[model samples]
Target: MGEKSEANSVAPSARGSLHEHHHHHITPLKEKKFRWRVTDEHSPPEIYNWTLYLSVFVFGILGSARGYDEGNISGTVAQTSFIKEFGLKSASLTATQQANLKSNITSMVQLGSIGGCILAMYTVDRFGRIRTLQGVCVLWIIAAIIQCTSHSVGQLYAGRLIEGFAIGQTTTIGPTYLSEVAPKAIRGLCGCIFAGAVYFGIMLAYFANYGTALHVVGRNQWVIPTTIKCVLAFLILVGSTIVCVESPRWYMKIGNPEMAAKNLSKIRNLPVDHPYILSEIADINEQVNLEKHETEGTTIISMIKEIVMTKSIRYPFFAIAFMAQVLGQWSGANAITIYSPQLMSLVGITGVKSLEMTAVLGVVKFVSAYLAAFFLIDFLGRRRSLYIGISIQLITILYFAIFLTVVPQAAEKGAVLTHSQDMAGKAALAALFLSGTGWTMGFNSIQYLLGSELFPLRIRSFAQSLVMVIHFANQYGNSKALPKMLLAMNNFGAFYFFVGVMAISLCWVYFFIPEVSGRSLESIEEIFSLPWYVIGRRGAELCPDHSEVNRVSYNVEGTGNAHGGDIDYETKPTAEFVENASNEGLMKSDSQSLEK
Candidate 1:
């Protein structure tokens, strides 16, 4: 009877405390509805607004610009007219000169990208995400104009370098911006749209190149396709300037909490103090405070030390960030993306047929990327999707190597294939297509998504800049080395090398990468704070309870103790308290009551 009375007393007080908490923010009439909505985990998707779609669309267009730039060289280099006009096809030039030309044209952009990314790291924080995007868009337009009117190889190189710089900056900023603005429920889907845009851009380039090769004459063939990139860049500039909202998280981080609440409300299509908006704002503010504490006097040296010396910060996340770039680059996908026409020719696909085949490959990649964005990423989860995709890539690359090795005509320079050799070449082409699918499904989308999620807010931009630097360095090396390597080692040796890299990547994903699906960005930090063993096991598990985090926030803010005079309605019994209650034979009833 005493226990029952105690329970009744506690219940009323708890209810009253919770009521007071709501009354602080909400009118009584709306409190009941707000409580129900905020507590429900599976609320329907937020209403789609033009501002939301426009933000994603602008980012997508920037991705398409990147795709167009990457795919343009593949088909352009293969054109007889392009080579003839540039003195590249002349017997007067040494093989080394020709290879150097190809490498420079492709690699200059990557070098530029590295520079642009470094600049973006500072600019994104200073000028804001929207302005940074707009500045790059203008730079890309000027670079495009230079390329479209180039009178010499030097001019082309200059244009590509500038364009590459712009692409690099956009690549870093676009996905990060999208991730920040998107609602957690559909964040994965929105993040992957950037990947989808990349593939779509690639497809546009391929088809444009194919049409030019078939119908256009002389330099116009290359000129028309190159100009298309400028159009995409222009669209992004306009969209960003006119339609995009500043990231609410950015506003919060910059000491504008009122503006942050306003922007978030606008994005969410809710009142400024709606429970969902309030909860999100609270999560953002708490995370910012935690990061500030973690890196008290933030500096380059201190940030580096924190990442390298802090076990919780380093192990899975820092390591994963580095590996994400390595896997994305060394997975052999970029080699195919930039050199597809050349690779197809090595497999005995020549002339217009090879260009068409490259277009088909682009289509396959586009479809796979879209599928990953819409269906695979959130549904299969990050780790499983990566494993499945890497497995397919490994199989396809091995098959490609085997086919090249067995068919001497495919590997031998200037050798025409026999009937059987032709069939083998076609089979290798099929493997190449499948490899694109696997890569898009696994590495392409996930790398960008993971890069955004892996770090705390305080150092996320710098950490991502570091990742992009390595990413472009790898791309630059591959673009510079791939053409020469293909000729020197035969296509078979190159595939074998990629196979070895992919094998290493597979092992890294299995042991190191954790599942992060369905967890809020703030919750991810808590997951990493667990003992390494438990983190490895349940890092991806949904954390339905927020009381622990609430307690941490209160304590960090120097608020009163959990059991003090003013009740925190958000607090719940700790594990120790629950265990003690179990010992006293009150566990079942107390647990049920607490849950209710």
Candidate 2:
């Protein structure tokens, strides 16, 4: 895949002119001017404009809408009035019945999300990213309205399932859209924003729940949160339609390269002929062409077969994509997010205290996700971030196991916790806080980032849908079974299960995941095309030789002459170079001239 080819070398004078003229536009200072203004030491800056940032911001809020739905129900279900109003607290209900009802209320969202993921798989590619998002935003609003006005349990369940479907779509598409449009230099950070938005939504839901619980005296406690989510959904609906631009890749995939180029130019605030803009388009075309060549028939079954059966593509690409979600879901992150109040009560912190603490957990998660998006992801790089964060999560879950073992009574939900039990409860809360932080820093965000980058454009939406289906399946199963697990094995046993799962996850990541911090989307394809065994420990070092393929050079003199000039050039290769150099020996004569 990294093999070089031959092409004609331009004359020295013409080549020098091309190099010098293009040089001014690709400089470090010029690149920094285009980069998103964020304080991070590790990530090199690249070109970005307000159009791209605005689109990303809107998508971030879309993610927050998903988070709001997930987090709001946690607090809503905890309300005394909500429980009584819905017969969840009725004396006729057995312990088993109550647990089932609580599970249904939360797990239904996962069911809805699964449906949404399937819907997005078809629509995102057919209707384009922005259009699909707009359609789902309307669905979300309808679901919210149904929830706000529900008079019975059946109606509430119906509303929640609908809401989940929309969220599921948004969660998958938002990151997909952002990944397709973001600059390579800050792609990880941009993807992290979607994850951070989820935490942000969770935080807002917690605060709303806490405030409503204290101030509102009736069923309105739950109703207000539902209504707020509805308003948010409406805003997203309007904004997505009016503000967001269509993904350029979607246009290119549909064979509308002209429109794709136009949108790309608009997003980058550059002319269609600008080297960066041209390079991005060429890169997309190169990847698309590769996919076309590999899967000639291009049917659903064939794509799956190509991804699963082909060794060169499967192990490092599809398998890694699938496991990224597995690690995230199996890490017990969603178990904690959906059941924080119940989890807290098991550790002897019940009543309003539990609600307050859940809100604080939300704050911690939001802050951690925010920090990871702006500072940690680009700084630590994706591979190291996943390792360190998962390790922290493992340690925190281990703490939970130990705390529950030492204070067995604390594992009994609704028990009147003693002073020591209270101390143990605080410890458990701290551990939960740490776990949430760890998840946001790595697994929570990196899963989406990797998913967006791993699959070829031909199968990206479908592949993401497949992964999301697995993700939501894990979430649904976990949400429904967690309450029962706590009852059967005690809180200690549950944490012990998660601890073991995370430990294995740590090893899997260390052995399989590769570093893709600053690489371009097209270049990522070449990295995966390498031998699978070589991808583990030194994957970043072994990536397809990008030196000449995408390398761009600049001259300080701003003149066409290469002699007696102070030159500043980027080793980063362009898409045209990558494609042209594939002709065998294209680099033979110009290799020295191309060198800085």
Candidate 3:
């Protein structure tokens, strides 16, 4: 007893002496260097400053480039003058010829996008996001050059393929970069920027095409519109390469804490010693170390296996890309965006007016998407936002269905049709604009952010690739189907088909998806464990205080002296288990459907 007492007494003194010696050795410079104190228990930085938002905004702008590439082609292709210059006159051309030409163009682009999405998954982690984006942009420039100079339809298709590949890479990678870099509080808003930028790009494309189509540039005028888009894309590509900062999380992944700290400080614009910054950096490091493999290389086989075999990851793998591609394509969005001018012309509006209204629709999409970013997503959370937007989408589609089926036709019996047949076109346009707003407001923002978050670090690339493949499948369908749909069913039949799909998708979300707003990236793993009902009902526990849960919720049993609050013994479920219970119905239905 005496010896133990003496040892205990000496331990404090020794510790104190060591502490004092360490204190003495820490110079002012060294103090500044290792100033930010963080442990696993703490949360990351909450407050965002102007500089951080500005830096992220630049990323948003770069994302807009993808949108520009997508939107430009649709509007430019519609102008009659462009058709004439491209020798698309029906009097001289067969229906077979037009179908073949459009199918060839759409197919090539979709295929290229598939390649880009898959390639980016592997290359992004190795070369870093910025460099990969730079490569895509360079390809865009080269493709644009080819497109502008195309003497034959085959060359145009080839150029589109290359452009599609670049777009595919940018669209997939940009959101991944944005979500990782953004703080949780504003992540949804930052996420919306990609959608907004895309709509804005489309709007810009429409406006540019409209102006160029009207330009007095002598003989062949299609050259100018394509040229302008290529120039803009090239400029953004170059600008982003020089100015964009590497994602702080990415820096941490590469085993460089100093650079990570420096970048974090720049991103947050907080002092280097900020508690939140330190916490985030530590969390990222912990995650990377915990997840990284023994080998440095991320192999293709491992990537595929991680997605398919892992129970925790497969759901998100299917969900996000499915949502993006379906909503972007099947939910009538791609068909609408690509054929807005034609839809308008069919309704009653045509020529300059149809083009102008298409531009207006693009603006509406931009504004609504930005508003979704600013308020709805962060405030209401992902599932609620999705519900609200999708509900509105359903309602809009219903309106189109009713109008299409019941509304009187424009051609009065056998009267000579002097003007463009417009009643159907107008109704379709109204429905499209309304549905688009809903699409952007909910699904567009959530899919990319949610998809990126759902997969584990090991499976992220494969999952993204798989989802994108699904997405392009829908894109290919919509692109090929639109003209045929328009020709066969007319506006009403085409609009109703998408309406039915939206209704089906809405049910999918209501039954299966868990709300995931304000949750940390790591916590997303829990999605697989909770019962789907529990997830849908409880939503995710967001921004929980990460301090000692025991201290916070201690149970006092059969004791006079009590400490803390009584705690429930119930343990949280894992993601895999949760998904199984939640998805039992879905699994059965899918099996039955497959059998049928």
Candidate whose TM-score is highest: 2
Each model's Cα RMSD: 9.7, 5.7, 13.1
In candidate 3, which residue ranges exceed 4 Å CA deviation?
Answer: 1-47, 217-220, 293-298, 407-428, 539-596
Q: Which of the predicted structures, 1 or 3, would earn the higher lDDT when compared with the native?
A: 1
For model 1 the TM-score comes to 0.83
**Model 1: residues with Cα > 4 Å off, grouped in runs:** 1-44, 47-50, 293-297, 411-420, 530-537, 542-596
Which number leads on lDDT? 2
Tens-place lDDT digits, model 2, residues 127-176? 88888888887888889889888889899999999988888888678888
List TM-score per model, in order: 0.83, 0.87, 0.79
lDDT of 3 by residue, 191-295 (tens): 777767777787787777777666644323456666665776677677666567777667666666667767776776644433344345545555565566432
Sort all candidates by lDDT, best to worst. 2, 1, 3
The local distance difference test score of model 1 is: 0.73
Cα-based lDDT for every prediction: 0.73, 0.74, 0.61
Ranking by TM-score: 2, 1, 3
